[model samples]
Target: MESSKSASDEGTETASKVEVKQDEFSYLEREFTSELFKLEINNLGIFGIGDFKKMLKSLEIDAAKVKTPHKRDCAFICLKSKEALDEAIKKLTGYVWKGKTLSVKIARPNADPYIKRKNEEQQEDSNKKVKRTVESQTVPLAHLTYDQQLEEKDKEMRKVLTAFGNNLRKLNPSFKLRKDEIPCEFEKIKPSPKIDDYRNKSEFAIGRNSNNEIVVGFRVGSYSDGSVEVGEIAKLPHIPSKVKEAVLKFQDFVRQSKFLPFNPEFNSGHFRQLMVRYSEFSKEIMLVPGMYSNNLTEDDVTELKQSLKDFYSDGEGNLVDVDSLYYQHLGKRETGEMFNPVDHLCGKTHITDVIHGLSFRVSPLAFFQVNTAGAEVLYQSIIDLSEPKENTTVLDICCGTGTIGLCFAKYCKNVVGVEIIPDAIEDAKFNAEQNKINNCKFHVGNSDDYIQSMVKEVVYGTLKKEDLDLVAILDPPRSGLHKKSISAVRSALDLKKIIYVACNPKAAERNWLDLCKPESKTYKGDPFRPKKAIAVDMFPHTSHTELVMLLER
Candidate 1:
């Protein structure tokens, strides 16, 4: 009987051990599938792993691991917990790091490797399906008929605009969007008159083509794939023929020389990128050649510059007009200062473009609308929406080159423009002077700083708020206005109207939500209600549309 009892006890102990093991397994599964969260970071350009970690540290986020899949300009970060992941996204999403605005979103559960290799197999299958579809439609883009291309473009625009409208309504439930005023529903997208070769600016990447030939074009997929397609400019409908010719010639010159294309994986090559900007109105062209020059000596750079000058000189190979030329040296650093001194290789230092009867001088690094003609239509839409009074003070935020603010100078009593880039402010002043407009002032500072200062001046009686009607015009970057700037606008009780223009509707919706919130710690004044919104199809073919929202207290 004692022997029987001993055997029974041993069996019970074994079962207890198995139960504990099962409980531990279940806990780990729950931890991974529910407690942890994954985030995908988009538009992460040239940001190294160290920089990404620093960003998370700044936001007080503890990430489990960060992965760069296929060496793309994106990062997948696994956080310790879902709450921490949410906090990191709240602070870092739409944050501009190194001139690239980041878009962060919650990644799928399959993004985690804890689920074994099933997710990887599924992803491979999906990619194969997509590749097959693309291969089936391998016909050259140029062969497509104009009407067919327009139809495809129109369909894409309609889908994107519809999504924008939906996002706006979802974000601001109390604010009513005038259905009749929505441009996408009421007015047809204004197709680009010059559909073929309409782009004024094109930036090309230097790499080895699929045939392993030295080429200057765009990458076919992620950088890790190491596959590039040469002569894409020649096939693309949006690139100008002249620009294509210049790029082809430059590629030939590079092939003849000993310089190598920049290898992003190894970060060891010389040539990097090329930018071409042309103005059809002024008939002027600007060429900027970017190179990784930390390893290159002074003599090598000088020889390269001379080679460029000889190639574009008035003698043998006058590929393009060669109006302006600049060589930019890109250093090996992860910062906003991407370019070194601008070495003027030949011709003028700047180019000019006429917009709405105003001749604006555009520097190599300055920001200008890619579609100059379409910009006129967009600016007119802003004006029509705002309808600035004669005795109004227009505050232009993120005023690049002061074009929008200067446009309002003629109608308003005073125009004050604020831009973060000092060079852009100088350009704005120069533009104002060139146009013989003296009622405008451009300040080099953050929009929020300048707005708060102006508000303080009015409160202290240095500036009279009652003398002029206040109208704010915001043309922020694709990331939209900063939270502080939005708060400053709300605090300015005297401001009567705000015209917010945005290229990315998603980012704009976030700002609009903050503006329309009933009560917030940042904003003290009454919430500004969305009065009207209109979509402008500034980009015809692509899935992008400019939106202008008018708000009032």
Candidate 2:
């Protein structure tokens, strides 16, 4: 009886290990066979999964999908064989059903279902594990020379910009632009000053490695993909040695601590994220440790913060000079988590970054360029392309810490910078004062709300609106500007030239169209012309490039 009990306990341990390795889909007991196909019906709002089966039966296809909610437009169905899949695709695609065209094809597996805990992001389609592995390479195109990468980027941008120009022509016949003028030239594709170890900031995830031990590094896959394995980032070329060393040391400290790394799947534990910002000029480093506050007393929290300070200030983590330390108690990554409540744990509250010979104070939440050296090259290109004279007033919109505006404030007549974040505005004002730049004025408000009135006040009070040259510098976020904001910028007649800095050109395409589109009730201003555009490689070893588009009326 004793031997049987021991064998039963050993079997239970083996089963638990098997359960740990199972993914989200494994719980559903999904049949991932080749015969499994997803069927999507047209007009599912009126006729849902119930009607989908009826239509399939009418076509003599004996396949039926899994039972789903009443309003589901799509579902996974199992067909007989390969022959049935081909026949179903042939018949269902473009077929008229319920006065709507029915579309059907072989559907890839669904992504991880959205978990409602933190509600940070919807699931990413992790259907193709093989494809995800290839895409996770640090530099998929690193084999190509820098010039070759630039050439490849140029080819892609040329096509995109030319296509946008074509769209402009189609919208208004009066629009006139030569194909050469669409994008400045292939020569204008600016290269980064320093490619490797160029990143000044990195946010390392706090999660378990394959061995289930706490690790400080990049996630092997996204949280939404049901893969939360954290692995070392030593292979990445863009990270500096100082930053890497700090990460390794911090990892050691965390592993030794009594607290456990936060588990997103289980929503329990302490540490969450480690965000490090290193300055190339000042050589100052700011560390903000992000963590989930749960199952810990007030004393526990105090002790944890003290331990971190002691470790970095005098203990093992003292290998690197830690300028500033911040504690970010982000309970959960909820939707609309705009401003993080960061407590200045110890040391200096702000780190200074010198760009274009001007020192700018960066707060824990301020938006500074990740690549400092590359930003200098990009800023110089912007100044060269825009040609702001002594009489020109640069209306810097979405100005974060006033980096772009302050860089060229000496050249321009004056800079009227606007930003939404109050902390960033304060830093911008401080930076201006520290640098003894009195000509510039920074405002704390939405750019769209203040732009039209601000332009009228600055121009009417100082110089004639017609005589003064006004240029608008738009550097909106990845989601791009709202329609109302675009309309507001257009309404200002004094603003003749627009230098749009697009971090995500694809997402920014709508704003570009709104600016250059024919003057309408919705657009509400003189249409601007796309004079020239250029790509700046701000992020190396990635598929992204910053587009600087110069538009004038």
Candidate 3:
């Protein structure tokens, strides 16, 4: 009986090892070709306890519903010996043993080795077409003349100085105003509020403005003499005791009410001391009868009507959809995309065809160009410079909602988009589906990880060759690409072109150095280098600028 028990125990151990190997094989197979694996399992697999456990482990089947690049639900599978893995899958799943080549499906839709390899062979031909065109083109910089540049610089300095003088005059009434109204210098501005009482040792105080609005702030140190001073003002300081009690009661009512937008004035100690909450005061001023009597358009008027409906609704309150109006107006006007919430109200749509034949809806949290018209020009420039074709396969990195990729898709064979934000990925997918665009695919996750793992996996794990050609369009954040991301792109053997878009030039320069470095792995064997550069005036009145560089191998 003891000998029989030992044999049974040995049999159990053998079963456990088989189960473990099957589980690992299932995982790798699913990771590489999930859809194909599922098809095989469902049509061929025999029911067993081990098979059920394998199904339980592959929860990623559901997670792939929203395929954000960084958060892709697929795993890395080494496909060096496809036959071994295929045989194992067939045995475990009881499927027909046919030696069909495995392929990537959902993880990278429409990504095929044949097409990518074909693109590699034809890259030289494409480069020949663009070489003369790009090399012969010279960007005009005549607008930045030396005298005009100096004049512009002087004007900016004067404007800043004038604003400083006005602030200083408000702080100190007896600072001796300039005769010619010359602007105040940085050194001339006071550090704190001025006060007549020299004995007061407190650091700060509040004051009322000419409009009887509370403006309580005081400075401790002076700019000229390094002296300390205080300024204070009271709005309705001499209210009757009965009126004060009534005001306090009214404040309590305002707090309990849910009809006000959050205003800093009400919560500030200086404003609260007067028993006049900011919301109550704003409503008393802004919510007056016939306040929006401007010559608003029909759409504006409709928006106002909707606003009134929301304001008066007793249930299901929603924050006024500020961004929707902005985009709608911009789209109608054919102008650039606008992002500022305040712009939604007064911003007039400029009639132009800048964004003609193109439309995109941005996610609330996504970072996009705030000035709509400027963005149109920027995107137009990208479209013009990219020179996308039916044969080109575009890869848009940091693709928010895949706008650029989708725009290029109608002209390109395929557009693969990558974004880190899940919501942005959703927007991209929705946009693609809405347009009935099958050539464009979006995934969520860090671009660096996707490039390092997914790109290589698709290339070597499946393609087994690094001779393919790829174009990487990088629109990294102001902080630019992480170090790992730089290394991945640098090491990629198939990349033929890289379009670097930077909101911050300084950060761009840093990444550029990393890419251009002779010793860096990214630049080792290839002769690819930054061939062209362009600057876009994203913000007209600000120091911020957008720079784009084209790199080619």
Best by lDDT: 2
Return the TM-score for each candidate structure.
Answer: 0.70, 0.76, 0.41
Report, for every candidate in turn, its global Cα lDDT versus the true structure: 0.70, 0.76, 0.43
Q: Could you tell which candidate, 1 or 3, scores higher by lDDT?
A: 1
Worst 10 residues of 3 by lDDT: 277-286
Candidate 2 accuracy as TM-score: 0.76
lDDT of each residue in 1-553, candidate 2, tens digit only: 1132343344334324533222433322433343355554443446655576787789887673454545565555666576777787788778787787776656654533433211322233345334333226455556678888888877777777877767766776676655534533434678888888888888999977766666898887766644677888777778898898889888998888877677655455678899999987888889999877645577778988999999988898878888999998876445566666788878899988888888989998888888898899878878887899988888888999999999988899889999999899999999999999987888988876888877887778664546688888899998899877888878887778989998888888889989888888878779887777778988787667888888898
Candidate 1, position 67, lDDT:
85
Candidate 3 matches the true fold with a TM-score of: 0.41
Clashes of each: 0, 0, 16
For all predictions, the C-alpha RMSD in Å is: 15.3, 10.9, 27.5
lDDT of 1 by residue, 1-553 (tens): 1132343344334324422112212324523343258888899887667778897788787787888877689988887776888788888788888898989988764422222222243446554643311112222334556556555645644554455556556555555654422322334445444655556777788866644566777655543232223334455656677887778877887777666676543345677888899988887888898988876788888888888888789543475677998898887554565336568888997788887899888877766777787788778877887887777778888888888888888888888888887767888899999999998988888887889776554345425546657778888889988888988888777776888887886667678767767656678687777666666655544446676778888
**lDDT score for candidate 1 against the true structure:** 0.70
In candidate 1 the C-alpha lDDT for residue 334 amounts to 49
Number of the predicted model whose TM-score against the real structure is largest: 2
Candidate 1: lDDT of 384? 82
Give the winner by TM-score: 1 or 2. Answer: 2
